[model samples]
Target: MKVIGVTAPSTGSGKTSVSLALLSSLNNSVSVKVGPDYIDGSLGSAVSGKPAHNLDRWIQGRDFMRRFRWLSSVYDFAVVEGVMGMYDSGSPVNLSTDYYFRKIGIPYILVIDVSKLAESAYYIAKGFIGRNCIGVVINNFYSEKHLIIVRKAFSDHGVPIIGEIPHAEELKIPERHLGLKTAGEMPDIREKAVHFSQFIDFSFIDKLKDIPLIPEDRKPLLVGGGNIYVAYDNAFNFYYGESLDFLGRIGKLHYFSPLKGEIPENPHMIYLGGGYPELYASKLAEKSHLNHALKTYSDQGVPILAECGGLMYLESTFESKESSLKFPGIFGGSVKMTGKLTLGYTKLNVLKDNLLFRRGEVVYGHEYHYSDIEDSWEKTMQNVLGKGIQGYDGLYSMNTQGSYSHFDLMRYGKRLSGSIAKFMR
Candidate 1:
């Protein structure tokens, strides 16, 4: 299918808004986010009636691009919403919008903020103008005169102005510390999506052409053979859509919430992804039965996979700015809330053979957390890229595993599913 990327000069330049508008304009189009960010992908998923996928180079490397390109061929058109800025790259590699555009070999439309510019919009577009940039989209232009001037500026330089979206108060999405609220929580998503689509010009939507379908097999992975309990709620909702999809394919996936004081009934394995666990530490601590259940399960050697916020929730204590709360203490580490933010893409080398990874095997992922464990423990993975710090990550104890790194299960589904299957066995 024809693929196009939507990028901005910088963050908060209406990239996600424009992407959702474009998705609404197209007849049969889907979108993906080009970073480890789950927020924009969630919004795009809600706006467009499709499960949004994240295409991060660090997590999946180059293979994900090819796979996504192939998978997107099923749709009439595909759009990729970029993260941060157009040229911003992650640490230790060229994992940015430019890198993905060049590697995926797709043309991108630059979204320029015209709220503060008229003629200067041309210069802004020029700074980002390259062979990959097919056209430009004027964003936040409230006045018709400003839109005309910005359009004329690009048009004068022989560059096409594809769309001009006006500044609207209702267009701004509600956000928390993590970013935009998950689409499920966002009110009037459909109404907002329709309103945003009115700002875009759909005449050029025909540019997206169909591509040859390369045969791709979609076989199911090794089944878990047992029910899997997944921690999911506002406090622990940072799971990738692909990860949940894979889980559904492997076993009967059930969701439980520590905040609700509920534990799954007889779970074979517990998968806690990540989210704002620190925000609800007190509520989680109040759930005595849930803590006891988790501790009991760990003592019984039931396999558990926890990441980032999940790691914090499984800690002995979760210390936040407001209050200190106790957890299961299944893992001895204690988490401390701090102003410091640890965010990056990581390449983890397995230090020892485990169900999820083999000895010496390398796995790629991302980490974004503000809380830090108070004490160091024996680590199973070594960080080759990003700030894994002190050459170690992931706390391993018996059948329990916890880490700060969030992985791309879509790219590594087979290996992870096989590991989960083994855990069930």
Candidate 2:
């Protein structure tokens, strides 16, 4: 299979847009994001009509390579999109987009935004020119003269120009506080992405060599038989595709929307990821029956895992500019929308045993949210790394666990399955 990595000098350089174009133009292709970004992966899935997966070394550790190889063997072509800038390091040093692309032994294309500059674009591209760089794609260029000047400047360094994309407002995706609007919210995003994809020159795929497939070393771990209720909808859709796949292997994976007043029956475990619950606070608040059902499930000692916006939904009240609304009241605290943004990779020191983690186990995860909870709530985990509230996280009650960190359950493998097995028994 042929693997291509798409990166840029910085964020908003049209990496996702270019990735969508590549997926739209390619055959039997799937998309992969380098880090823990749920939004871009959703966009990729929308365009390719395939489940997009994430490959993060910090979160997945050595399993990253195994996941990459498995993905390569499944599809004819794969387009991996980089998180943030190409060289922007993660929690540890040298863990960047360029690092992963080089490690995976794949050629990457650099995207450059040339909307404001012409000849200076060459300097920007020069800094990123090195090993594994296949070529450069100029985005948002103005005119024929502008494209010509940028092309002429790149001739100095002998950097291959892959394609040229002109400026078009129609191609841009809308954004909110938490990055781009999800593909589910934008009904016509796929059509727009297909139209925008025409600008990319996909002939570069012919020059790339195929990566040999590796043997699948391990099988997916399955817990005891039971139904795992997962919250999925516009209000709560931030979940990893691979994680969901793993969940399905464990048991029956059922999806219900809290916004639509739907609740699962006889659930062995309940998983709530994260999303824009604040946007639909009023609608979610109206679901009194759903709230009561969640509270009853929590009381029954059913293992419940909630993160970020999911944590907000379980609170007594969610206060935003739109409205102050009531929720499931499982946490006995209120969540308020804040102007301050807490965003980074997080390391958690578990203070107590819970559904997803063991006591004293250190877990690595990512946190990106704009809401803050009252400190009066009980905390269960201490944050040894990254910015967590007052050096602590994880709200605990009965068998339920809630936190701001988004965990990649695939990293835990059998350990997670074992934890859920205990609850199932």
Scored by TM-score, the top model is 2
TM-score of 1: 0.91
Which segments of model 1 are wrong by more than 4 Å? Answer: 211-215, 389-391, 413-419, 422-425
Q: Where does candidate 1 clash, by residue pair?
A: none
- Model 2 per-residue lDDT tens digits across residues 288-322: 99999999999988888898989989989987776
Which candidate leads the pack in lDDT?
A: 2
Score candidate 2 by lDDT: 0.85
Q: Which ten residues in a row have the lowest lDDT in candidate 2?
A: 412-421
**RMSD in angstroms, all models?**
2.4, 1.7
Q: Which sections of candidate 2 miss by over 4 Å?
A: 321-323, 413-425
lDDT of 1 by residue, 1-425 (tens): 77778998899888888788877767677778888887787777777788778777777766675657556545767788988998898567777888877776777888998888889989977988888676888889978887888788888889987777888887887777677777757768767877877877766657655444463655676575667889988788787777777777877889987779888787877888888887778888999998999988888777788888888888898876666788988788788877778887888889986546778888989888777786466788888875553557777877788888888766765655665566566
Q: What is the lDDT of residue 151 in candidate 1?
A: 86
